[model samples]
Target: MVLNYLFRRKPEYRTRKLLCFSKEQMYEVVADIENYSSFLPFCTQSNIVDQNQSELKVKLEIGFPPIKEKYTSLVTMNKPNLILAKSCDGELFEYLETVWKFTSVPQGDPMTCIVDFSIKFKFKSNLYTHVASVFFGKLVKCLETAFINEAVRRYGRSSTCIFEMTSQD
Candidate 1:
């Protein structure tokens, strides 16, 4: 039990935010996996290995100081609504999944959307999991901010009101 507590399994992190961009705008930002390295935190490289109408296989390299890893993921796109990516490399991660959901804000401006983002992951090495757990929350927050900043850069601010949903860990 102590070991389990120390090296947690499949920790999931989630956050939702109301943004000043339309659902289509947000979806485009999230679905463009090949551009992740340009703006995403810790992403060193992003390359699309394969791509079709509804999906993409991408290889990503992420590094933070001494901890660097490269992995491939299968990204499934549901267009203007959902983008889900699952890790394909078992050597680095036992499992890793990221989900993004975009919906129009109810009773809000047509140019606004509610973005729900979640990531679930477990490292193959217990030591890595323990190390990553310490920085997981902050890392996820940074990632969220990166996307928001990118959206603002691309589309400009549609509204001044930005709502943050309570985070779920």
Candidate 2:
């Protein structure tokens, strides 16, 4: 009982499926840091303070109910393959990291790709952590759906296959 509660407050790992989109297309959607607020959940604003071929400095404002926070992060991208973002400074979080990995489907199986998305974060405030723990699973699902919906909106859906699993799976 105690362990369950403790574990819920720590970093979480999740894997989901994405189908029909090429690796490059999926990469473009995730790497477009400045447009995140338009699709991402609770993201009120996003700005690219600096950007280059390999890295981007971005700030995002997210809010849920009465809580609102802004944080800056440096996102490093490796073309149409991998993207990683880490929080540089944030009052509400101790650490926040998210990774997106895209792998093309085997040839002859249609032009599809598998997107592996994972996020780990810890809040600095115990009160906030407690509040978040109750909704973490749902929050992750919303984020995943947001990305997929955005992809369909932009690239048009060809095939769709989405499944969710935790580290336990």
Give the TM-score (vs. native) of candidate 1: 0.91
Question: What lDDT would each prediction earn against the true structure?
Answer: 0.87, 0.81
RMSD of every prediction: 2.2, 2.8
Candidate with top TM-score is: 1
Clashing pairs in 1: none
TM per candidate comes to 0.91, 0.87
Alpha carbon deviation, residue 24, candidate 2 (Å): 0.9
Residue range with the least summed lDDT across 10 consecutive positions in model 1: 160-169
lDDT tens digits, residue span 55-82, model 2: 9999899987787889889899999899
lDDT of prediction 1:
0.87
